[model samples]
Target: MCKITSELNDLRRPSLLVDAANCGTEAYQRRRDLRRMLRVAIPPTARAALEKLLPIEADLEKRRRMGATTYSFARHVDILVALLAEARAFRAS
Candidate 1:
């Protein structure tokens, strides 16, 4: 005899067992992906904004390379957030 399973059966177990979404690492990876996506989406006008922003990140990377203090990375991250927010706002307008 052939049998069929229902979606109701699929939901019978606790959700935590069924959910496969990676949270912590997935979130970090997704943030990186969003940043990459934004870089690809930038227009010529916005490239100026990105160019202004990239120096801070480059400085942070330089510091990391030279084994300097990590505190400065936060500022770079903040600038990236602000740049992305401005881009999103521009798009929303």
Candidate 2:
């Protein structure tokens, strides 16, 4: 879990992207994969939060493809990180 968080932190670095389109792509994919794992690992009670976050993350990716600004990409990363934190907490509980 700490390794996942570290990967996310690396993805958050602005220097990772040469352009906005790819800024969140890798992180988005990683997050999606994590979401899949989390859905099963986390308790059923926390599934509602996962459901709410999924579409938001998808939209953020869409925005990125649509040429969202670097700041928007950064914000997207922030939201993913928060979602991961929420999932981690749910798993820990």
lDDT by candidate, in order shown:
0.42, 0.52
Which candidate gets the maximum TM-score versus the true structure? 2
Candidate 1 TM-score versus the reference: 0.36
lDDT of 1: 0.42
Off by over 4 Å in 2: 1-45, 69-71, 90-93
Q: Cα deviation in Å at residue 7, candidate 2?
A: 18
Q: Tell me the deviation in Å of residue 22 in model 2.
A: 18
TM-score of 2: 0.42
